[model samples]
Target: MASRYHEVYQSWKHDPLGFWKTAAEEIDWVSTGEKVFDPDQGQYGRWYPDWECNTCYNCLDRHVEHGRPGQPALIYDSPITGRTASYTYSELLEEVEAMACVLADHGLVKGDRAIIYMPMIPQAVMAMLACARLGVIHSVVFGGFAANELATRIDDATPKSIIAASCGLEPGRVIAYKPLIDQAIDIARHKPDSCLVFQREELAADLKPGRDHDLGALQAEAVVAGRRIAPVPVKATDPLYILYTSGTTGQPKGVVRDNGGHMVALKWSMKYLYDIQPGEVFWAASDVGWVVGHSYICYAPLLHGCTTVVFEGKPVGTPDAGTFWRVISDHNVVSLFTAPTAFRAIRKEDPAGAFIQQYDLSQFRSLFLAGERADPETVNWAIDQLQVPVIDHWWQTETGWCIVGNPVGLGLLPVKPGSPTVPMPGYDVQVLDDAGHPLGANTLGNIVVQLPLPPGSFPTLWNADKRFFDAYLAEFPGYYKTADAGVIDDDGYLSIMARTDDIINVAGHRLSTGGMEEVLATHPDVAECAVIGIADKLKGQLPCGFVVLKAGVDRSHEEIEKELIKLVRDKIGPVAAFKIAITVDRLPKTRSGKILRGTMRQIADGETWKMPATIDDPAILDEITEALKTHGISV
Candidate 1:
């Protein structure tokens, strides 16, 4: 490990460009670089020049090139049924080939879309790799999504096929996944032509008879073919994956990240930020559907040619919340990354912290917190609890990976309670005001990038290229607006305050309320809706929706709540709709038709309801006040 880091550091200091060139050589490439750097037409100011490589070649085939094909790649566990699974690189390659062949045989050609709605099994990774092998753009929806939410994503992606399992474990219980797929397909406006289901014997929901293709059967057929599953040549700018963002606007945005840029950035980040050592186990408690998983759990570690852990079961449910610590102890993971929310929950559930103390965590060198704001309390608790340096970093779906971080004790600036650490190397960060001009240090403003987009920065939006430029680039010429408000302290550490938009952060992930409101507004009985994040003990903040019923609309509170909740689950995923509150009267608003969401937040917090002069309806304030009292909130 020392030799590897020393070699990289020496190379980086002696000749940075040469270091990149050598690093690039480590991966298998379909097209070698004609020039080390090629900035065609002055795109992003010469940083990323005409770089070329296939993503699959870098992520999967690169290991085989280094003669470590038989090394273990993914460690999976299903706690509900006491099933433990491991996949070696060779085994993974074969499964990837078989899955790719199955897709190709089912009319899934290059550029076709494939949706994977399954648990965190090894097959899920196989499915993703299979798509990459065949150049099929994959959209992986989290398995916890409801039927309606799954249907909406399927409608949006319009994939050629949908892959799922019959049952899977979540939070200790076995869940029926096929029923969700079947229900989603039944109502899907743009249903897939093929549905490949991995049937499990222990399932809660009944499976459909003939409409679904058996995954085992398909794999058997692929084994008989005996043909090599060669990867299709893909351009650097080709779409690698489409991950949806849960924005405040209630309308999810499909963030399209290019292959070459993301791969380069994530790889560099893993090697530098996590200090990944070869042969050392790395565990990141993040779902593959999330950007954390996309960057760290899959791309970064693989690109760096390091061993990684990918548990299929939930962190809390494998016999208790101690499962994570036990796994780390069992696997001897050197670097661990997870949400601060999970750590807090574990702390609350495990008073003795026995599981954490029982493990010899001396091997664990680095710990990172994300997925929601980690308040000072949680950060200090984690550092003391884990007895290791805890690095709380911040980034978003748009940024792709950690843009702000406190390096593993090296070059680490000051520690701020709720701060997002410092910017990474090669990044130029600034806090910009409404005029788009840079603000002085310690001033609050929207966090923006002063220089050209970074390596991990997504170049375009999915089906909304113009909108992408308008939202991120046009508003601030030559700068990318992050839409998040934060302050950079004197020591240069960034403290993320809040989003500039109506988006709510539950745990650490952003959820757009506008998207949920769009679904509610679609219902004839709904007149207006407002959603905001109320402070919570567990999740940092949870979305609390306040809706106004249409005139003469008759609906019970439970019925309306159920229906509106259903609407969100159908429109987005279940993870985005766990909290919804509705009021019968019109929401307090400004004359410009803007909902006074801050006022609502105050009401939810049980503070004295003070109507800002910007509010349009003063009487509506009284109604909201009365409603707050009903919920045991004092005003």
Candidate 2:
């Protein structure tokens, strides 16, 4: 279908405030704001600062009060636990109400901060909504993160309390999170006033006598007391949550989301961006800790009065590679959003896509991929298998939503295999050289968005306005530096290649490692691939390719490596200097599925690097180091 994207984008360009104000009317506001945007406020100005509303009310209570009381609001499917549960709007509202009462009972009130560190469970969703219900700012660190990292967030957010789980279930074993939480609290100077632990059947935690309390017991008590807490009214500018970007170190960088803009943007995204209708099943295959999980999995689907799926399992190994298809077929899902890495993993394991045929995906209309570059090979493979529009979109943790995406809701524009279509209505995306001047079409340069970044984007970092400005705004002066390198085609489609630093200098030429990986991924034997530029004193930097082969491939690694090397050289030309390609068991990634390219590069360069706290498996790094040595490529 031909898209009206041009007309819609022009409408936004013609009247930005008018467009947003119209979108804002869809939300139920306690009181409307006098101004759509107040440029005189915030580090970069604020949105709907004068308005009053409850985000929890919009996402939960309003839906129940309105016509969606009996409609499925959330579906919990955990393959690891062999558990499946569904909550209607009424039931979810009751749960959230009880959770709110629990929070209030714990001495929390409006403006208090709390940290939620838990697995991908229903309680995690309830806790977030409960915090929103009481207007307490919540910060969700990744579930089962290392002790020191959690401790850093504990110190930074300085929460009044901590909501955690006893354990997180993996494929083979259970990860006890209680010990990590204990160590984190012990390491941090600012101890929480209380701790609420949700006990899972797999492992029950030994709660500390004075500080810890069991979540089920408290929730049961709250339910029995017949206490009903109304959603607390908060200014639109009031923070809803503080999400620390993955891989925080000494000082945590928390991305703050305000209540009003968050609802306005996410609700709008559900209808217009994702093309999902209310009451329809929409699944974001992500953890509640990440931004995708926070927006799509927990908030957006519900805000739009749609049923959202909370999946407590991996893309594969939750039984087999077909778990995703099983869930979609069972739930009657309309759309599924997930990282490209997941498809890559599934493609690696089930190269023929045989498992996909095992399910009834008649209701599944589309697939959305993000969180990292969606290589063309994987995108095409999905399109071929699902016979659905495989959309590759781009956004950041700070933005909370998409900057560039093929708006499936807008009637998807022509799918460009390498590009994430065009900028959404809110963003004025530009490709700029180091000097801040906009580059011409197809020119590779740093990506930035014009000043007054659209609604739903972060106003400022939590308690660190200066750092926020310095990190995002200061570099480009009048632009929000995305810190990503990409090219905008003549039609304005964005091809995000890599981080700004990932643009490797080959002798005197700058090349994209992502471009090389795209070429390498086309190889039939290759399941997935990563290309990082290792330090080369002679050429300044050289592209190092790591390819993970598909299952049941008997081809020699040497032969596959040669083919991959040739493929990149032919596709990207000799200028890319793509010489080395190696086969590895797997690529090290974050828990969220982003390849640890920087760490891999650092190791290959023999540079001193600390272990990334967010690594999916630390042992993979050792495997990477051994792979590098076998190739006679650095340490």
Candidate 3:
């Protein structure tokens, strides 16, 4: 089976256009054209340029039309709100059509952008589908983003309407979203003509007259008026959505995904990467704001006629460390996908594997990790605890889907502890030196993809095509600069070492901070760890490590720090200069569990740093600052 998969991959590499043309036939295109790919058109490639289709029809309506109307399409589980609901294919279609009518009734038409700022509720998914149904471009901001951050996105997108919920239910608290939306509207110069609020009964919000309207009430009115909003057939090149990702310069770039190519690639991924079948449950424990959520939680599973779980609770909160196991066991989830940070948290809170043993996870077949590089320690730990293959894949927000992954849908390959397996069928991944020359095996260099990025990948930035070209395409003439450093081993497996910026130049030798962090994570005392480079006059830069110890493990900070330093020297080599190690109660992270290493570097360098809007806890930053100051380090 593995050989067969490799054969398919080779065929794709040999004839990329033929591969995509075959895949395109699987979708319900309104008018299938002969064009497969256009690479020289304005220098940015476009896929299936002359095709026409509706994304919602491919995701929702087609499944219902094929006599699978009663099949379960969505399973919403929100422990915070104590709600569990299931929607069938037919039911989801009705809800989506009703919401589409409501959107149309509000004077929203094709080509208009709608900003959706809501939690992991059913409405969020419905709103996204409705936008796709009407050919309206939707931009979903992370629910945890601050008003200023939201305002920045609004100003850039200039959305015609905004959809939000009253509040987001977290553990023991309700985060008021309406107030933030209102504040962002006040701050942003380009205001939306309309605001639609989904009033969560747990915490209702005030609606501004003539500006804000009730989403549910509008849907009800549309239903009462017997409005049947059919899916709009849009050109293949029409923009589907705009997702904003942070740039190194502190500005955000809106990555644009088109309808036809995105639909084809995502639908293929559902069966090809995850090995999910119709009616099986697939749960991705990520927020809707992120790309993982956009692909897996909302679109991919539904596109393949599978039941996607929309989880509205944290990995550790609203319950306990066993929250993930419980969700999988209760829902019979076949494929469980999440970040490595989540597993690290669960391992920290319950190290003995006690909580996990309480549940029957036999239904869970494979566990996939992404968002950040998966340390070998965490990957091996999950494999041992779950008794299943833990596959670590790599992709970016710009790509919109997995570029490097183990095709579990075909067969399980030999597990490489630190590698994210081989490149998928469409990605021609290569490691290039700073001068755009290919590097040898085991040599870390910038990760780049050869020209003609696969379907479903972002074609250009929204309203900033030049910025996109300068940021990605222009760096290497015939390659998309990934801005990540990695190496391909002798076995052809790619190991992402670190972000290019995260590589510390110590004594003219490049050291991967991520590699050092992985080494530190192997220490028995360490629960979670992050490494950042600080300016050093003698060595150019030195590695600084922050660690969170396992719960209930009472060990002296000095003792653990000493062990960690030696661990890094032993594993990564003595040249790492990994002397400084500070034990923190918790590492600063975003709500999505990404470590804030940049913020840590700012504090370590004694430079002024503004608190990021996406930070999960501002107090943790203060704690880190105080800890550094206690060590007699100048801050």
Candidate 4:
């Protein structure tokens, strides 16, 4: 069976187009064409250029048409709101149809854009499907974003309408989103024609008369009026969604995903990479704003006729450290996917694994990690705790799906600690030098994808074609520059070292901060840690690390710092020059749990840096700055 998988991979490498044509047959398309890929039309390659289809129909209606109407489609688990709901295929189809009617009734036509800012609820999924059904492009912003961040996305997308909820229930509070939407509209230069609000009733929020309309009322009205909205067929190359990803600069880059190719590629990934079958539950603990949620949570699983869990709770919050375990056991989630940061948090709260052992995780088959590089410590911890194959995969927002992963469906490969295993079938991944030349195995360099990005990959930046070319394609003439620095071993397994910028040059030798961070994370007392390259007059750059200790660990700062320095020196080498290690209460991170190393570096270097809107806590920056100052570093 594993050989069969390898044979398929070899076939894809031999003939990419023919490989895709076979994959494209997995989904229902209105018009399938011979043209597989067109690289000349756009600087970035375009796949399934001459086909036409409606994504919502492929995801929702087809299952119903095939007599699987009672099959589960969406399993929503919102522990924060104390709500749990399930939607069958037929029920979801009807809801999506009604929502499409509501969109049409609001005067939203084909090619229009709608911005969705809602929590992880069924309505959010409905909004996305409704937009796709009507040939309207939807851009989903992370619900945790601030008003100013929301305004920036609004300005960039210039959406015709905004779909949002009045409030979302978090662990200790009911956060009103309607006010934020109103404030974002007030701040944004491009005003929407209308706003559709879902009143959660958890908090009070005033609704305007003419512009703001109730989402529930609109759906009810559509049903009462006997409005029948059919799926609007769009060309294969038509835009599906514009997902904005944060860049190194302040501006966010809107990545555009199209209809036909995206449907094919994602549908393929659900079966091959995730090993999820139809009717099985697949849970990805991520937000809709991120690409992982867009691919796995919303579209891919559904396209494969599987039940995708829309979880609206934290890994530790909605009660205790056993939240994820309870969710997995209660929902019977077969394949669990989440971030390493989440597991780290769980490990921090329950180091003895008592909470996890309380629940029966027999239904769980595999545990997948992404969103950041998974440290070997976290990977091993999860494997031991869960007693399952804990897999780490690497991908980006632009790619829209996993590029390198352990193919649990095909056959589980030998687990490599801190590596994302191997590339998937469609991708030809390589390590390239600064001059775009291929490097030998074990040599660290730029990770590039040889020409012709597979289907489901973003072809261009939304409304910024030249910028896309210059940012991604221009760096390597025929390959897509991933902007990640990494090494591929002789076994062809890739270990993503760090973002090229995160690679610190110390006396001209590149040192991976992620590598050192991974080593530091192995310490039993450490909860979370981040390493940043600080300016040094002697070696050009020096590694400075900040660690968050586990609760109840009463180790002194001096002792912990001394132990960490010696650990790094012994594990990595004396040449690593990892001298400074600071014990901090917490590392500054985003709501999604990515450490703000760049911001930390800025504060340490005394460079002017704006407090990012996505930061989870602003005070942590100040705390880090004060710690740096106390260490005799001139911040």
Best by TM-score: 2
Across 286-317, the per-residue lDDT of candidate 4 in tens digits comes to: 98878888998999988999988999999987
The sequence of per-residue lDDT tens digits that candidate 3 reaches over residues 1-635 is 54456887999988899999988876898897778888765447799988899999988989999978998888899988789999998888888898998888788999999999999998999999999999999999988578989999999999999988888887888899988999999999999999998888988889999999999888877767767788999999899999998542477889999999998998888887888887899999998898999999998888888898999998886699999999999999998999999999999988888988899998888999998999998898898899988999999999999999898886767779889999998899999999999999999999999988999999998888789899999988999999999999998899998889899999999999989988898888888899999999999999999999998988799998999999988888888988899998999987778888888898989998888777888999999999889776788
Cα displacement (Å) at residue 349, model 2: 0.9
Clashes of 1: 17
What TM-score goes with each of the models? 0.76, 0.99, 0.98, 0.98
For 222-327, candidate 2 gives per-residue lDDT tens digits of 7778769999999999999999987523566899999999899998899888999998999999999999999999999999999999999988998999999999
Instruction: Mark the regions of model 4 whose C-alpha exceeds 4 Å error after superposition.
Output: 1-3, 224-226
Ranking by TM-score: 2, 3, 4, 1
Tell how far residue 186 is off in model 1, in angstroms.
Answer: 3.3
lDDT leaderboard ranking: 2, 3, 4, 1
Stretches of model 1 off by over 4 angstroms after superposition: 1-26, 33-51, 204-211, 224-227, 409-414, 502-635
TM-score, cand. 1 = 0.76
TM-score (C-alpha) between model 2 and the true structure: 0.99
lDDT preference between candidates 1 and 4, better one: 4
